[model samples]
Target: MADTLQREHAGVIPGSRAAVSAAVDHLLERQDARGWWSGELETNVTMTSEHVLLLAFLGLPHDDIRDGAIRHLLGCQREDGSWGLYHDAPADLSTTIEAYVALRVLGLDGARPELSQARRAILEQGGVAHARVFTKIWLALFGAYPWEGVPSMPPELVWLPPRVPLNLYDFACWARGTIAPLLIVISRRPCRPLPFSLAELVLPGTEWRLRRVEASGPFAWADHLQKQYERLRIHPGRSAARRRLVKWIRARQEADGSWGGIQPPWVYSLIALHLEGMPLDHEVMRRGLTGLDRFAVEDDGGWRLQACMSPVWDTALAILALRRAGMPAHATPLRRAVEWLVDEQIVGGGDWQVRCAPGTEGGGWAFEFDNDIYPDVDDTAVVVLALLEAEQTDEVRNAVARAQRWVAAMRSSDGAWAAFDRDNVRQVVYSLPFADFGAMLDPPSEDVTAHAIEMFSALGVRPDAPLLAPAIAYLRGAQAPEGSWFGRWGVNHVYGTWCVVSALAPLHIDDRAVSCALAWTERVQNHDGGWGETCASYRDPSFAGVGSSTASQTAWAMLTLQAGGVGDGVAASSGARHLIDRQSAGTWEEPEHTGTGFPGDFYINYHLYRHVFPLMALARYASTDA
Candidate 1:
């Protein structure tokens, strides 16, 4: 392969083979002693701000921690004196309010230049009165915002069975974990008095009123009734609900002290337990509070918290990239990674079992190191594929078989797979007043379904396999008119199209659709021989596959073209050139966020993307240079 590539295009890119070698060495060097890989999961300043507030709410001292986070927050503020959900995004009212409040809590003077500028940005964006429901709830904690102005998620939701319309399981697992605890906080209405006031956040004439209702009339009316119910202190089933909720929250806390292995649930659950008289010195609270240190990264740049960690996801992807780059399966890093991943498999039950097929024994991987109850189909499928590269052991084989069954059983009714739930396409949940953040339901997405299909194909599952055919149909039905697919977990159309095409290309399924997608990839290629898409594409279809060139999206585009059997085509070759030209020592520098947490609400810059993906694209392109 190296000889053929050299004879054909060495002049066009003399460093192609060298680039692949450098990237491989770089990835090998990145392996941790434990055989896992983790890149910094960077979101906006809201995570850091929330961390500070969480410690404060618990009456925990954050002296130096507070100063470091304040530095990080101030550094992240835009020239407009506001924070955004993603880099270079328009100022988001909720994010600005949260950061401003965090700065205040960290003891920055409201009259300081930074705070004054932020206050102006807040008022310009409709002031604190227009913040999201979640933001308002945070303010209400410190007696800044009125409780009546925030939406009510009554604790009574705990009693609803799975079969009921608004049952606890109806919400996505993350939402379920968060809402269960938040219900306790709302009912308790616990307030921790702040040293100062937020009177400056309210515009001169603006009063606390329900911002323009984002939910349906009926849902809004239901929330109003709940508020009135709270006013009357009417509670027939409140005690039973609270007990169930507390028990439920206590049962799900991971060993690392986080709830659901994410920030929202972790912070909120601690507060809820504290409100219910769980002592700070108790083992659970102590572990939960201190476990947050694992998520914090402090340095010259100051401190920031990850919204969630991604070691399992990062390790699987890194191993797969090495294998794709033609690394031997017996290579030391690959062997260690496979063994570690095999051990990381969750054999215990989780919330997913509620909606999964009957008798679906747990054998899947969670995205985090310790989240046993939330193993996702996406991570499990990818891990299975990576494990196949290594010589299978009895333990590896057993883990694989169990994972296959779990993935198969996780199929939603639409013949597709969601990240954490089966058939979790509850639309009514989005109509609730509290559902302001982007995605409340974990509906089946094309990207995850594609991964599942690819895994089955590698296992030689027949085309007519029960899950295979319907999953293919699901992808077919999901393709946009312009031929791209919607990326649920990644950035946008480019990521989704690459995943689907990469899966279908080997099966020779829907040749016309594949060709159409290939054309779309080519059409969206930037003038500079790469591809990019803004996170805005999630809310605005017109922005699909449109943005400044970045290594990750370019690699996704290159892979899509190669999957369509056009690795030598102009678009693919140029994308390869783009990666080769931009390489330095083995990795590209990517500051842009290419990962999605929630479509319009949260975004992530997986620091490893600049390394793993470009290498995968360049190596595969070189060996398969038709």
Candidate 2:
């Protein structure tokens, strides 16, 4: 099997030189003089539509950006008159409803054929009454649905201690931050009505109704009991609880006025503050609005808002790609990138400390430019790996050591690292009716574990390091029966398998595991000389490693093949050709959002992935040990 693989990739390098040089030169042009790269992080129209809604709700005057954003939403509408959550995703009920409302609010006549078609599509999907919880909450705010129809998130629940089952601290940082503000919105049941009704989305006689509750057993009982308790507390019997909840939410606000560095929490927090009687011009409220505004970008293509900004994450990944393409780490461009990364390291307490064991100064990187309250293990690992490959200066030395300590302390009892919290494994959080966006708990994942191991290896930690064996055991367990691993943050098995192979190759782990994994990835290669896995793979394993070829997934598969020692021959060359064939003027065209925000709920197109990953692949092919 190994011999066949080797022969297939033989002499692939020389064929890729021109493509490699083009890709590398293109990427070098993208770097900042001070050393960073940020491409737009694109999401579905829901993000842009929702931003319009937030701005309107705040009574902010509609500006040209909003006008451009309106055009973006209209442009993205499917020919069938519905909207989807991701590219090629079937028309989603929640997204269509949101986009339709935002358009209506922005002066698109509800009587227009475009609006009528969307309304029909939404009604066919069971109307706003059956949309996702988040969408339902938005409807309730607009007075389209009664607050009683939505799930109760009583403010008093914030009073629950950490030891309790449903404490806020038990939620992932994103969940807790977003929900804290939502609880305030739900508690007050604000009925801010829109100028016109969206009666078109409803069927002939549909009425607002609360979701039914039916559960058995103790776990189920606790869930129903919460709803029953919701009815008993008319205004959440405790004013102290409200005060503490508000204080808790406000204290975590980033310097930019976002809570936990994301849009949902910021938008919700702004609404919650207004309801709580903070004046519109209040400093905190003003900052939050500015922070959200900063996320918007308008161009000739139209306007869109990143669900979240990712300069720190994108910069690190870009550095790795450029270095792999034969740029010396000591070069000024690369060194500047390293210096910028060291400056972004987290040096103070964040929400992670609420669950983390004490006694370590905080040291890691957050995904956004200004989110200090949350720094993720995955971003930290990526940055550390990139720095190790760069010219190791004094700043890099201090940053890496601090990250190593924080990472070491964050390792779960199972020996793997989760993206956010330590020991945050409560299954009940996900089963909660209000908790359906997928990542309720921050349990360790195979891909995150692989990156941690690779980071350790890059830092020259011994193979005998305490975290190594447990993480290796984790990889062994996560490997598919057919030998692939599941990627939590990337697309699917291809991304996961690549992470494992990258870790094992450098560390010289047992060959059997690596070989089986390599063969599994190779077998799934598309006829186009690439790999493709739909996000549907999350709910159905049969779709795992199956889909139309994508530039990012193809590069990942190529990277895995090279790591397995076929050494950039036929298979690698073919993958490079797919990238080169698809790229125009140095940029690769990829419509599919390859980065996973949440498996079923959200997905992302890291616009840079197409260019960066292919460059990484072709560069390795051009520099193989053949």
Candidate 3:
């Protein structure tokens, strides 16, 4: 594999395994005491800035982690003094408005020149009126915005049936878990308006009424349900219902105190509970707070919210990468990671089985800790792929076979695999009033399907098997006209194209389809030899193939090219050199976080991705013949 490829390129080529090992050691030192890693989970300026405020609210001194955060924020500010979804991205009114408010909470007064400049920027951007629906609702709670003008959220609707078209179960689990408590708070309509008018901070003549949506009137079935429930004021069995809801919420809260396994709504739910007079010392509050702390990864630099825990996910990927790098399957780090992956599997039935039964007992793993309600095929597939490379002790082989069976059961009728659910065919779930957020329902996405295909291939499952044909057809059908694939989990086209091409390589796919996909990737290669896609690509497909080069996406591209057995002398050597040149002083410099399981509205740049991927790509390329 190595002799046939050309080697000359621009980037520094890592000289030896010793250097790579040292680089890995340096990164391992940066891991938190808890055996996990995390970096920034990017959001709009307001959310990022408010995140800093939350740190302050939690008692970190201004000088603590504030300086770096402020620098990051300042770097991202628009020329108009407002902020946006990302640095170098266009100005977003809602994010800017929220960020402006957050800066005030951080003790920046409008009279201060820098603060004044930001205020002017916010006012020019249409102030709170142009902000997102969630931001306005937050303001209304603090009386900074009018409660009456905000949309209604009646708690009585909790009693709606799961089978009902508009009931809570129809919501994406993340949405349902987050919004359930928010409904309680919104129904109470608590108001503690700020002391000063925000007129100076808003655009002139901006009417609050213009931003308001009526609590009544039918649109979706959910909206009609909202109207019906609004008329009820309170449920006839209100006390019993409240107790049941609280018990249900508490029951689902992971060992770390979060519901639905992530940060955004967990924090919001905690605040809502706090506002409802749940004492900080109370068991529920304590559990939730401690859970937040558990997710917190600290360093001398500061702390970050892991969008979710990644031990099971990271360990699984690390094991696979090590095996691919030609490390012995029983290497100590590989063994430990394999053991962790095995232990993380869920034994009982979860929410996913409501659609298809994941046949094996102790079927698969979820992405977070203690989340037994859902076991995602994506994580499960990846875990199985990793275990397949481990030392085949009787226990290990059996575990791998069991995981394979579980993934087999998770295959959708159409041959694709969803993240958490099976055949989640209801697109209408996304049209609900609260569905303004990204990806509420778990439909089988392209990336997850690709992953499942790869896993089955690794397990030596024949292409003619019942499960393989549908998935292959789906993958081929899902390919875009330009040869790119739409990535639902990562950035738009680049990530999807990479995974699809790599997965298809192991299958006996049409050579034309494979070559076209490879050609598309080669065409989109950044001048820097990496690949990137902005989150906007999710909203507008035109932006799909564009963004700054990133380490993880670059690695994905390299892996795909290598797997497809395409990219002869010039392209292969060029891509490999690009990665080598980016390595700094024998270590790879981490770029802006780029591993995203969700794009645009939600972003996550897994910290480990920066280290693990570059190493895998460079090592694999170095060992290959050019």
Candidate 4:
């Protein structure tokens, strides 16, 4: 493998056994003594800002969190005076509107220079009147934006059956949990007056009747239809619909008193409980607040909140990286980590069971703690894949079997695997005026499908297995014209190509598409000998595999080339050198948010990826022949 390849492209390579060993040691140090690694899950300012708004909604007094949140928001504001979903991106209207309102709630006067600048930016960006549905609802709660400004989401949506299109189950678990509570909030639009109003933030002469200008696509009129439907709530069974919706909402709350571990659901659930007449001291309310507070992280720079937790998910990935780096499966830390994962399996029913075939045993994992009610296919597959790399005790094998069964059962009719539920491909839901965020449905994505396929392949599932055919077709059909696949969960084409090509390696497949993908990877190598794809790639495919080289993405490129059995040794060696040279004190400097939380809407900085991925890439290099 290396002889002819190394001769084709000569260059210095930095990867070594020592570098791999040091990387493995650093990862081990981060793991808890009991076994599990959890790095800080970082998000944008909106999380902390929403934290303040949630506190205000509950009538909580001023506290240091409020002060620290404001500081964090201020620190994140660009010179143009608006907050982007991620740092260094352009200003986003919804985020800026929410942050401005949060600052006002925290006592920033209208006369403050920063406030004035933010207000100017808001007006420049069309002001609060033009913000998204959720932002308008937040402002409406304060009697700042009118209730009529936001789209009406009737609680009656709760009545829709699972078999129907646009039903509650059609949405992903996060969106489902977040939107159901808003049904009550929308039913009886509660107002919590602030000492100040956003009068100065509103654009002059802007009408309170917000138009759905941004809503466009097939069923664009779904916006008008939704509003008309809201008016129909005045008919005979309206009260029944409302009550049933509340019952459904209350029933779905997780054991931790959260609807889901994510911030949107946690905050909205609290507001929904309040609207249901639950006092702040009520057990549900108290537990919900405790769960919310647990997500907060305060540093000397300031306070911020994670949108969700990912310890289990992080630990699983870390184990795989360690194993690839030559860490024995029976290593003490690896054994402990696998034990923790086995214990975390969802052994009972969840929202997934509503559509799952009867007798399909319950077993999967979620992205966060205690989110047992909604174990996602992505986490479950990754956990299974990691366990396959570990010593397969009976417990591990049983865990894998249940999870594999669940994934196969959850497979969409298109033969693709989605992150959340099965058969959840509802396109009409995307045309709603309230669904302006473009994440209305959890459709099958390449990265997710690739993970599952790789899991089957790694487990020695036969090439002729029933699962391989549709998946191969899906991957072939999903390949980009530029010869890459869109990475739904990671950065961009590089990550997707890596997953797809690697998974296909374990099975005999048409080599043409795989070759094209490898060629693209070869052409995109950075001048510094690594690979990178900007976060912007989520928006513009032109930027795919284009940006400052990073450790994780470089690893993806290296592994993909190595797995595809293409690319000269020079490309592989140079990529390895980049990762090795970048390593310092057993860690890589990666402040970039490499993880994707919500494709284009949100991004995450998973602090563990930099170390884990580089080690995996280098380890592959060490084991391969030249």
lDDT of each: 0.88, 0.82, 0.66, 0.81
Clashing pairs in 4: 2-625, 2-626, 3-626, 14-577
Q: After superposition, which runs of candidate 1 have C-alpha atoms over 4 Å from their true positions?
A: 1-12, 208-216
Residue pairs of candidate 1 with colliding backbone atoms: none
Per-residue lDDT of model 3, residues 86-201, tens digit only: 43556666666666666665565668765677787777777776666677776775567765455666666678865666566665566667777777666666665544556665
Query: If ranked by lDDT, best first, what sequence of candidates would result?
Result: 1, 2, 4, 3
Best prediction by lDDT: 1
Cα-based lDDT at residue 506, candidate 4? 51
Q: Residue 122's C-alpha lDDT in candidate 4?
A: 94
Q: Higher TM-score: candidate 2 or 4?
A: 2
TM-score for each candidate, following the candidate numbering: 0.97, 0.95, 0.88, 0.94
Across 194-233, the per-residue lDDT of candidate 1 in tens digits comes to 9999878887767835334445688878877787798785
- How many clashes does each candidate structure show, in the order listed? 0, 2, 15, 4
What is the model-wide C-alpha lDDT for candidate 1? 0.88
Off by over 4 Å in 3: 1-79, 195-199, 214-217, 220-240, 275-277, 297-304, 358-362, 590-593
Model 2: residue 453 alpha-carbon error in angstroms: 0.3
Error of 4 at 88 (Å): 1.9
